[model samples]
Target: MPRQRTGGFHPRPTVLVAVGTDKHRFDRLIGWLDDWYAGSAARPTMVIQYGHSRPPTIPGAVPFLGHGDLQRAMATATLVVCHGGPATILEARRHGHLPIVVPRDPAHAEHVDNHQQLFARRLGAARMVALCESQAALTAALDAGLAQPRSFTVTADADVQAARLAAVARVGHIVEDLVAAAKPRRASARH
Candidate 1:
């Protein structure tokens, strides 16, 4: 069953932190938020770490919940900030929230040197999401986003259609290949 949301337009925006496999970006976000909250008393902050290990301390931060709390918290979040994990980005999109994506760098030995940076760069370039690098950039993004939180609205259905068409094409190709393979070998075309 699809997880139920926590409900309502939250007055205080939340930062939903999801770092499924990569720890570098996760640690960076945690430390940055910890510092941000420490210096500012204007608004409340919630840090949801969906990582494997216990998230490091973030002093005076609100509701450091376990994995069970993730779906609910994400539902309620006004601004979702996550490491560049495809699953997490898709979840943010599913929740109708435009995410702040700080992709995990694989070069620093952060998650087997995968495609995080590539994906993050792509989305960031398109302005489909915010990409955060330094703590300063994150602070700016946080303030701007929380000042007024906006949801992600799907404007085009082309991609969806394209995906479906691609699937059909692949299936057709497989069928053709199968038919050709199933044919018995010709007896040297002639006796």
Candidate 2:
């Protein structure tokens, strides 16, 4: 559960990690995050939506969150770390978070294919996400986000809206491509 500060009394910053609801586990991301949190001297209030992955050793971890809860978490979080699911990325961006994205790797059995990596790389090229492909990159990104929270946030409403629309369009195209690519394989298998 996330803690809410009242009366303008803020205690600690919150970091939210969301791994999408795919059946394939994302232990790689969860493991790295748990290790980082354990090693940090001044850990923030952290919440992890672990999904199909094993539960993190961290206290604030949950298997899944309802849509509203996830939105609230994103709205209140100081840093957002998430899998490279387009919807998750878009949601984080909608809340002004330039999310640290770790795309699920098919080589590691984290997803169905390399689509997440491809999409995340494109967004990274466009400066929309802090793409973290390795544990070290993720560590550096986490440190940077905590050190300079404002840098991860989009402050202007116009900029946020523009980025959101662009991302949505790009994601739509990617999803279409994936569907088309799968159709051939599905038809071949049925033959």
Candidate 3:
């Protein structure tokens, strides 16, 4: 089937992979993507932000990208594959792509905890992300995305965006309250 364009989404054969700026190595995800690329005859244009992981075999791989550059790349890409960082997933969604998220596994020493997996599962349950925990799943998601690009493109939902921003602000307020509660009280000076 020919690729479809929906919601101003152009069918481009580009893929952007972001492993985040965490200190832990996400070599597993990089390796999986590289292996998949090697076997793909279609050869989608791929750019990877490898962060602290060992260098990828894929060309066009960069250690990091500036915020403006990353957003620009996301705007043009047909697909986004990213580690389970919520910010990256949100960025992809903001750019109209439903990201394929591979949560870093703590068992593989890819993270200090399994928070990524937990957060990703919550987003996956809401259909906000295409969660792929295994190489086979990732391959299938990528194949589907390449074949029918529009399926992954999402129109901006103003209500949903507002809700997300509100939630983040609420969390920030809670954190501030907690910090205030923990701080020692300054005694009044009676001169």
Indicate which candidate wins on TM-score. Answer: 2
Candidate 3 error regions (>4 Å): 1-12, 165-191
Model 3, span 28-127: residue lDDT tens: 9988988999998768888899999999998889999999889888888888999887677767877778889999998999975676787788788888
lDDT for model 3: 0.80
User: Using Cα atoms with residue i matched to residue i, what is each candidate's TM-score against the true structure?
Assistant: 0.66, 0.84, 0.82
Candidate order by TM-score, decreasing, is 2, 3, 1
Q: lDDT of each prediction vs. the true structure?
A: 0.60, 0.83, 0.80
lDDT of 2 by residue, 1-191 (tens): 22322212236878999998888899999899889998987589998999999999998999999999998998788889998888888778767788899999989998767888988898899898899999999999988877778778754356566676566657745784786599699989988
The candidate 3 region of ten consecutive residues with least summed lDDT is 1-10
Comparing 1 with 3 on lDDT, the higher-scoring candidate is 3
> Which residue pairs in model 3 clash with each other?
none
Candidate 2, residue 98: how far the Cα is off, in Å: 1.0
Which portions of model 1 show Cα errors greater than 4 Å? 1-9, 22-25, 50-54, 59-68, 151-191
